[model samples]
Target chain A: MSKLSARSEDYLKAILRLQDQKKVVRVKDLAQLLGVRSPTVVGVVSGLKEGGLVDQEHYGYISLTPEGKVVAETLLQNEELLRTFFEEVLNLDSGEATQNACNVEHFITPRCRERLVSFIRFLEICGRGAPKWLDHFRHFSLTGEPPPCDRCGEIFPGDRRGCEKA
Target chain B: MSKLSARSEDYLKAILRLQDQKKVVRVKDLAQLLGVRSPTVVGVVSGLKEGGLVDQEHYGYISLTPEGKVVAETLLQNEELLRTFFEEVLNLDSGEATQNACNVEHFITPRCRERLVSFIRFLEICGRGAPKWLDHFRHFSLTGEPPPCDRCGEIFPGDRRGCEKA
Candidate 1:
């Protein structure tokens, strides 16, 4: 759960996708999907197998173990949520959203994923009020300012001489 | 632009934040923020200087030139969008969302960023119809099934071999 790298996660997810589409996955197929070499796919597959996330025979097709299936499902859920957020909430194009989600989904932690889900729900329920605080919550974008102090909700001016007391 | 690594972007962002806060950024300070050694910071600083993104003297405090500020701002914007998406939509915890945004923001492309923004807008304006699709989407979460075919939009039976011919 905690040990997968983004690269490894990509491979696992790709395998899962292939499984969904074809019910079987091969090294060459995975390599083609990932735009990587067959050797690279082999290396990653070996790693995944060792991790108990993949099951493979000598030269047969590849598939996810039950645990692998769970991980892949979770990763897919995160990727879709992120893609939807990026595409529906942010007004991004579908292709770009998918690509970005593919990259971002791996690095996200479960806690962060939950928060993102909450934020999306708030947007759904609260509407306009959501963006106002969201704008401030992410105030780092607004002028490259230091985040407002969590305690006082005061904008900490970036160039202050010393606001140690304030 | 495409040449900067996530680590490099993090360095640039740290320098930009420091410059905004202190009006001057020292090598040791950047090293502290990045948890790297001073020599490592010096190397990255030299690269940034070569890239025309930063101004540095032999031993003087470092600062970003105007061009560097633009890049930093761009990175900050992407990070904020990602944070908002994660926190507001996904229910991810704020602190964890922020940290994940920090890690992935640098890697996202402008095209992808635009799509994410658009997608968010779509979700906001799409209204009640949105929740209906949520269950269909959640099917992917429950089962490792490929989404209904892109063309016909019919859920493929588990025994199906491929999308139906048009």
Candidate 2:
């Protein structure tokens, strides 16, 4: 995570997307995708090349190095996971999920994501055994009242009950 | 998407997490949870209050307004979905899935997420009825080549060949 900035990750992801579509990507293509100037793309690409994350041929085309592909794949996988989560469990509109996934992907820690995944699996299993799980979730939505405490199994009424032992 | 910065969203999310535990969140607690100075929490709380996203008492205890609760719930739901996709479908390590989910939650589009969710459902169905579908997918692990194009019904060989139609 410390190795790349959000901007650099975007650049790598853009390159990966373009490379998937075509044999190579150009600076202009990256500029268009990133909404940045060609010079900015060039600088980023140069930085990527120096970092051994990308390979460029005569400035005409760009591609990810094997290492770069690994990072890109990691990012892509994360993006897909976020997309699935928003669509399936929360029932948010799809366009909103995509937009949110794009924004949230840069800041998550590995450990937090793992716990979230486990929670999701728990939901999926619950969903499979009882379609009413979603209904139950909806019935007990986290709104004016707080949902049951995950750790203590106590339901707090209204919006602001102080839990001394939470 | 432009309505909130990632940092702001994070604050909202942190607030929501604390709400889940304590029902009522205090500025000092938020500052500690967020690893920021109390002044920073104060500033964000003020902004949230102005935006009608939170209700704060004179003592600095805070809880989300209805609108704020909705936003936080939505964000949390997205995070959960991403976690599911990365952990279950992609078989990523839980930590990686969670980290990825945090980043991916903000970018996923509703349409893409719907397709992904339906696809996951379809895969589950296929897994139950036709083990071959699951087997085939398993055969094409990340280390292996990309699987056959669903449209062309032909296995892609290497990177350059059999991908033109894909």
Candidate 3:
């Protein structure tokens, strides 16, 4: 997971994405995808090839090695997972979700990733029915008042005994 | 915002932290806080002094310029905000919360920071009574089944309509 810098990781990701979209990955395609010049792409690609993370054929076509594929796939999956969590759970918009996910994809540890996975799975499954307190959350976010939950009133006294603290 | 690298930003933060904690900051103290050598801290402090972000007395004590204090305070506040959000909202462990906040404090944009603030303030105020869905979330996180919210059954026809999707 820590094998390469974020820039190199992005190169691998762009290669995989371009491969699916265009069916052939070229050095120029990578440069365009990454918004870099051809020479910069050439330089990074050479380093990637030397690291055994990419294979370059005669015509400047770039493909991931098996090791590279695994790394890229892990990174891509992490990005998707983070984006989905940001969108669904955190209620971030599409642009913010994508940007935040990209910013965070390279940094999440395996433990944090698992915890996020658990958190999102819980939200996706539980929130399908849209519980009543979820509405209070919206109301609170908008109006600064939650209007007091009857159930919580019954469940606990003052100071909110059962809920976890920050 | 884009003026300094993350390493440089950390230097500013450590100087501020040391200033408040020690009342006197030294090159060696900065090295300890940043986990770099004294010479490395000296080099960065020189750059920071030239950049008008830090002042070094003849002996060794380091102090922040007014501009530097503003930047450092902002970063420290952002770090605390992120740490609190991770702890309260995400329910992460203390170690994980601190680790993740440190990893992300430098990268969040002003817009994202505002959104995070709003989200956290909502939770802090609204979740005070420990609403029903909060328990359901805990239960679902633990048991993988929400036990079906009765209120949701009446409100939602099939797929949840009111709740925002990720």
Candidate 4:
């Protein structure tokens, strides 16, 4: 199948979320959730129907085809993962993280996503009770420079570049 | 200014790169570089001209206005940072990193960009001679489980969950 546009993916994801929250989804529900008009929802839903991504039945109730469900679920997963990474690992505020995740979810590739999952997992395991290096990282973020110890050859003797390696 | 479409940003970035490499830019050169046709370039260039992002004069030679150059430069920097993060921090192959970087750069926000910068800087500083946690991460990636030491209460005493902290 061809890749769905970001707008289409948003519709799919919104539809899936509505499906999760309620038994029946109407045009107005999706439109309200997406902050668009009913006519706009009608137009996009028809396109999605043509694309085999959704089914409209029973007086405007919307349902996802199996493939559509899969696509929507994947995008939802990507969005959640990005939100977690941004909020937990990147330490951005919840709103900032949500916004960034929404922007990035469609664009991040599967390989990058896999790597991200692993990075988070690594932190979960290796950072039990929060590792000391994490504090060092926080310091670096605040100062825009590595701390005095991580800067020189102290950590790795004879590697003189220190924090200036870049 | 309003946000440019991804297509418009592509045109602007392509112009910047071509400008960096040579003195003059034509629609054909842009089309060749972008692997699109000249007519498409002409159409988009007209829109960009109206937006004050570019100028087409002296037989189709293209030049970015100051604002256009700033926008293009920011996009270029975002792309490079993403490429470096994917390649160095994520350990993705060069080609995969480049492809993901290209897909992600336009959508990433300035705040998210700052976090990514800090993350890379953290790695550069704290990961001198490769942190052991990163090695554990590599192991986790290959085996889909943290190593024995990380899985128990060894790293952090009384923490029985160990690698299962998630």
Q: State each candidate's chain A TM-score.
A: 0.73, 0.75, 0.81, 0.80
lDDT of each: 0.69, 0.65, 0.73, 0.78
lDDT of 3 by residue, A72-129 (tens): 8988999899889666555678898888888778776676787678777765555555
**Model 3 vs truth, CA RMSD:** 5.5
Identify the leading candidate in terms of DockQ: 4
CA displacement after TM-score superposition, residue A96 of candidate 4 (Å): 1.9
Superior by DockQ: candidate 1 or candidate 3: 3
lDDT of 2 by residue, A4-55 (tens): 9888998999999998997679999999998999999999989999999999
Ten residues in a row with the worst lDDT in model 3 chain A?
Answer: A150-159
Interface RMSD of each: 17.9, 18.3, 6.9, 6.0
Maximum-TM-score candidate: 4
| lDDT per residue as tens, model 3, B1-166 | 3498888988999999999999999999889878889999989889999899998877768999999999999989999998887776666788898888888877766766776776677655555543444455556556666445434433221234552331
What TM-score did chain B of candidate 3 earn? 0.82
Candidate no. 4 TM-score = 0.84
Question: Order the candidates by TM-score, highest first — what do you get?
Answer: 4, 3, 1, 2
Give the per-residue lDDT digits (tens) of candidate 4, residues A122-154: 766655554544556666677886656433322
lDDT of 4 at B20: 94
Instruction: DockQ for candidate 1, please give it.
Output: 0.10
Prediction 1 TM-score vs. true: 0.64
DockQ of each: 0.10, 0.06, 0.28, 0.34
Over B23-134, each residue of candidate 1 has an lDDT whose tens digit, in order, gives: 8899999999999999999998898899999899899989888999999888888888978766655545688778878988866768766655754553343212223233
Error of 2 at A81 (Å): 14
Clashes of each: 43, 34, 2, 0
